[model samples]
Target: MAEEQLVTFGLGTEEFGVDIMLVQEIIRIPPITRVPKAPDYVEGVINLRGNVIPVVSLRTRFGMERVEESDLSRIIVLQVQNKVFGIRVDAVTEVLRLDTESIEPPPPVALGMDSHFIRGVGKIGERLLILLNLDNIMGGEINHESA
Candidate 1:
């Protein structure tokens, strides 16, 4: 069976995983500059080195109530479709490998937010992880908004 490496993180009580290949780097939350007229899920832009990247709040994206950032809060920088962005997560749990056979398609019902954001559901022992479709998370609209 083929195995996929995943970077797991927490959002509220639920856990989510994203393909490690998509992850550029993980860093502590930095000062975010809010964008005018931008989507509510977008926390804002941040300066990493010299490049500016928009940061999306996974909580807001999932329709979950916002919480104050804790020490565990982090931003996972990802590159999807050649556009770089960051996703603010409650806390990063751990990096793990999941067997492809243990994955299932997203459920018919929405998982909190939109169903399209989910790639699949992965099972690891007693845990259920919501795999994310990074492409759909921002889609093409975000690029236009940020530009």
Candidate 2:
């Protein structure tokens, strides 16, 4: 059976995962430079060793209530379609491997804010992971918004 590796993290009480291949690195929350006229979800840009990368708040993107950043907060740097950006998450839990068979299609009721960004739901023992579609999450709309 084929297994897929994921970089799992927390957003509030829920767990989310993305393809490990798409993740460049994970870093603690950094100072972000707010952009003028950027979307609310666009937290701003960050300088990572001279590379200025845009950062988005997943909480805002999902229309969730905002909370104060804590020590567990993280910025997950991801590269999708040649574009690199960071997503602010509550915390990063772990990198896990799940069998492809354990993933199931998302139910219609699961559709919520930016539901299209969800690839599927993975069932691993007692845990449920919301698999993300990185491409869709970092779609062109975000590029246009940040530009």
Q: Which candidate should be chosen as best, given TM-score against the real structure? A: 1
lDDT of model 1, residue 116:
83
Q: Rate the local accuracy (lDDT) of all candidates.
A: 0.91, 0.89
Clashes of each: 0, 0
Best by lDDT: 1
lDDT of 2 by residue, 15-93 (tens): 9999999999999988899999988889999999999999989999888999999999999999876789999999999
lDDT of 2 at 83: 87
- What's the lDDT for residue 52 in model 2? 98
Model 1 lDDT on a 0 to 1 scale:
0.91
Please, what's the RMSD in Å of model 2?
Answer: 3.4
